[model samples]
Target: MSATGVVNVDDARVAYRLHGRGPAVVLVNGTGGGDGHWGDLIERLARSRTVVTLDYSGAGETTDNGAPLDLPTLARQVAAVSEAVAAPHVDLVGHSLGAAIATVLAAERPELVRTLTLVAGFLTAAEPRLKLTFELWRRLIAVDREGFIQILALTTLSDKFFASPLAAHLDALAQGILTGTNWEGLARQVELDLRVDIHAEASRVRCPTLVVGCAHDQIVTRARDLCDRIPDATFSEIDAGHQAYFEASEEFAAKFLTFADGLYSPRRLSSSVS
Candidate 1:
């Protein structure tokens, strides 16, 4: 099934798509992220369960209206998408900045979330190294866009991935970013990333939570702090860097499916909906 629409929330028009069948899984993309960022994993996950993906305001097809942004406001946008797509509860997968938004939703609107997966999430942007990295990103976007893209690739991929045979695939990804990146939207997201603070929200998430960490992530580090803050949150570490999900799709999917299947009962959506 294919149904794509927009949900109005405050000043933003959030673009969303719901497809596949069985159970419900809502995917929230990170900074400058769109559903396509999930790549092959989307098709794999969609094969067995209904998958919902959305564009945050100022990203992809979503409209920002030039409104100022904050973490909660972004979370509200995600919450709106969840309400439009899921039933009583839906499993949530959030990566990077998306993780912060998901954390807020699971905390403020616990009933809407069945389970939570925080991939490369952070409790705060106060970390000196992470903060410095974001600052450098913003500066690079202003002075040298290609340099910024290169830096992004550097921070996202690990040394082992570089040695692997996926250089061609990763090169294609970098090319896509260079050609298709939304500079304005990305600049805004970089600002939001520097300001994200979800420690309070993390404490309130009561649903079964998984915290995924990357071994060589230069962007977001100290994953244990995020896990420790969330009560009983489980922790898992992947060998790749920040973009582990993309670099290690099969492993990430296997881990994700295992966690999600244990929490949600499969409920297929009919081909046609009223």
Candidate 2:
């Protein structure tokens, strides 16, 4: 928190949390995730690698500009984070919409990213059922605020994770969400995500990639489609739902470090992904 550099991206001065010391790994949160959302994962990854968490413009710490946002707009912010942290190349991990941003970044700015991880990512929306689900998500957020959050959680979380300790932590969830959520931003995010089709965009990613999916995920169900798109991608699934980062935090963190270590072999990784 001591005098970190800020880059003005349109209306938002992107805020990035930088810590540890080693090859940089950038953690990009989902559509509604703020900087703190990656706390559990970052804490574990930081033991051996520098981790930077960022909020996309109009998402969390970044300012809200009424300007229309798409994947391209978000990718620019990823570039900003990489430059601000002085990371010549970064291992980018993105969840939900952030995963899409990471895909675009790795594809377009290949030099900025060395390895990529996509969790519960919306890659191929060709399925009729998933397309319907995506549309329903859009409408819910546009109309019912409470219903949107409830359904959103239902789609992203697995039953096991919900029944676990996190089920009783609504206070923690609410607090974390309140950090950067507003009515307008929520609506805009819904609109942007529903409209995005990252299938064609994903094929452009050439970096060694890892795609994670949840068996019971309610939100983004195109995990298999995402796995198939990347040329050299490794695909796996966790028993938990879309919020795997929290329910299976330790597991996901281990997988993250392992995959990233494989990309940068100069230093061996000691963290566990299983």
Q: Using TM-score as the measure, which candidate wins?
A: 1
Q: Which residue pairs in candidate 1 collide?
A: 23-267
lDDT value, candidate 1, whole model: 0.86
Q: Compose the digit string of candidate 1's lDDT tens values, residues 1-274.
A: 7789899998888899987897788999988887768867788888887889998876888886776678888888888888887466898999999999999999999989988999999999999988999899989989999898888888888998888887768768778888887778889999999998898999999888989999999888888899999998899999989988888888888988877775443452311111
- Candidate 1, run of 10 with poorest lDDT: 265-274
Superposition TM-score, candidate 2 onto the true structure: 0.88
Report lDDT per candidate: 0.86, 0.76
TM agreement with the true structure for every prediction: 0.93, 0.88
In angstroms, how far off is 27's CA in candidate 2? 1.0
Clashing pairs in 2: 155-218, 155-219, 156-242, 254-272, 254-273, 255-273
The TM-score between candidate 1 and the true structure equals: 0.93
Tens digits of per-residue lDDT for model 2 on 153-255? 6777777866777689766676555444665776677677767788777888887889998777876676888888878688988888787887788999888
Off by over 4 Å in 1: 264-274
